[model samples]
Target: MNTSGGAAAAGRAGNSDALEHLARVGLIALGIVHLLIAWLALQLAWGGGSGSADQSGAMATLAEQPLGKPLLWVLTVGLLALAVWQLAELTRKVPGLRSTGEERKKAVTGTVKTVAKVVVYVFLAITAFRFASGGGQSSSGQEQQTVAGVFAWPGGRFLVGIAALVLIGVGVYHVHKGVTKRFMKEIDAAQTSAGERRTIERLGQVGYPAKGVALAVVGGLLGWAAVTFDAAKASGLDGALRTLLEAPFGKALLTLVALGIAAFGVFAFFRARYPERT
Candidate 1:
């Protein structure tokens, strides 16, 4: 054992309880955002004047409400705190991966996941800031522009192809994770009642696959972009959601997925309630 590393980990552990609660609040905020998205999706399903039904759209809708700026500011702070919490987690040692190879592999994978989470939270924080400041832009438009710009570069097609493949893989992983109930491993058994665990599991069974389907749709769009060399085809979440609108029985499908996403939001609440701080 490295003494310095051990000491650092111990110091982090001492503060984990407090930070964990803060992270829980952040998770709640995340759930709220997803719930809003689900509502927008429902409206779209009913041919109502729903906005984009993605994260930016969600942010835009929030900005239109009373005291929206203050709410966004609060969300930003919570998200930042969550990012910091993940940072602390990235530094701490894994408890159960005792074998050298297992530990190394687990550490690397964990770090990557934590880092990805940090990026996501930070991006959301920035998005909130943008919306609060009245400078929000269309996420799909930006995504298309970004993809177009990427295609301008040498080997950009290859890069875009790689990204598409990665997203596809991630989508598959999420579906598999949901099917296998692997996410339950993150729950603190001591903190969760049997009923609560069952509820969380059931919600996750629907939620994860719904999210996976959305991701897979987005990946297919990106793949289409690569194949046709048309960056406009590589629209983000908004495009994927809208694409569902064009399909046969689209409204019903969209509504079902929206509810699944809402279930995910509720699942996040349970996760916040019974987090296993590793």
Candidate 2:
């Protein structure tokens, strides 16, 4: 009986570890998908037309494209999945309140992060659906209509700008908590070696800057568009790139920015593959 019990316990332990590993992999995959979407959004925001010969304006150009609709749906589902995975990880890591006050504080932080993640995912889904449904006015017919008629309502740009700000704030708070609270220590404890610690730290560092830059660029563009009531002028990614290119030093700067964003995606890919040994 004792021997049988030990074997069962070991099996359960192995299964639990595998589940955690799978959850981590899922989270990483979701992150990569998001980064890819960001890159595509950036490419479109730049001077690259949707590769279509249509007379459609910029919005229509993006909407009518084959990749646009699929990308939108992919992002929507991926973000929701990410949110769920994050919450699950938090629950697994902190199944209950610890006796120590510090542990309790960490639990609170995790809860806040989970909530923030849910909000971001919800808004992202809405944005994706709006884009996919042709409600965003990116089609040729919508483009031919008055720009005022489409952009005047302050729907797309305004909501996205607000969501970006919230995401940035949440990301910053999480990073701060991670560093100050030494949350990575928990991860390190689960890891086997010092090298794993270094790897996880590097991933965290890269993630921080990427999230910050994305938030700032998207948020700033939306805010500017909302105030100026210029939907065409306020579009994300492309508009920002266009503004940069129009400046005397804009082209060079835009190139560097694009490369930096792409590099982030590359970094994400690496992190996802190797991940932290935890």
Candidate 3:
């Protein structure tokens, strides 16, 4: 028996536990970010101050508060932990992956979801770090620049179109999850009260579709960018919300969506409180 192997296993277990703890805290940080974004979006909806309503903008707002820098550091660490946790989940084998066809399909879908989360969390972690270090930029500007760079490449339009389609699919999935109360699968129902379940369900019903609408608009903008060969049309979340203002009864729509987003942020707090261990 190699004592060294046992020591390494113990070390790995300790690290995993630390990462799990961080991931739990990260969920709370994520909720705070969403709540900030919701506030900015509401300001726009109600004809108030001018501020970008996106993740980067949220980070910037956080930076303006007391102890903001230290908070950024904590957010950065938490997000990084979340990214690592998702990556680990993505790579881990699914239970009964080889047992049945339905199980195999579920495993594949779960893997894809985990992979997407890993990408999102990593991007968010980078954004958090940038704000923490006082080196943040407008998310809208960054999106346009990235789209422009993509267009400069050969066959870029088609690639952008494909990306738009992917976004739409993701949006639809969120809507479906919300409408179907599928998100409850991630909650430890056995540990929750009936009232809590009802509250979560109600929140999911409103919040998920709101997120879906936002993503759908973002995808549409990307599609416009692809079709017109104009990278400027491909804006981020802030751009999407502004575009909403250009339509009929836009303010009302934006306000509704903003409320839904705020609800999602509140739901995220519930998630932090009642996470389902894998």
Which candidate wins on TM-score? Answer: 3
Candidate 2: residue 178 Cα off by (Å): 12
Query: Which candidate ranks first by lDDT, i.e. highest?
Result: 3
Model 2 RMSD, rounded to 1 decimal: 9.3
How do the predictions measure up, each by TM-score?
A: 0.90, 0.49, 0.91
Off by over 4 Å in 3: 1-16, 94-100
lDDT (tens digit, per residue) of candidate 1 on 1-278: 69668658755853667767777877887887888888888888888855788888888889889998888888877777788877777556454233478777887788777787899898988998898888987585888889999999999998999889878877887788789998787678678788888898998888888888788888989989999999888988778878987899898899888998898889888878887755
* RMSD of every prediction: 2.9, 9.3, 3.4
Model 1 segments more than 4 A misplaced: 1-14, 93-100
How displaced is residue 129 in candidate 2, in Å? 11
Clashes of each: 0, 3, 0
Q: Worst ten-residue run, lDDT, model 1?
A: 90-99
Better of 2 and 3 by lDDT: 3
The runs of at least 3 residues in candidate 2 whose Cα sits more than 4 Å from the true structure, single-residue gaps closed, are 1-81, 90-109, 118-211, 225-234, 237-248, 274-278
Candidate 2's TM-score reads: 0.49
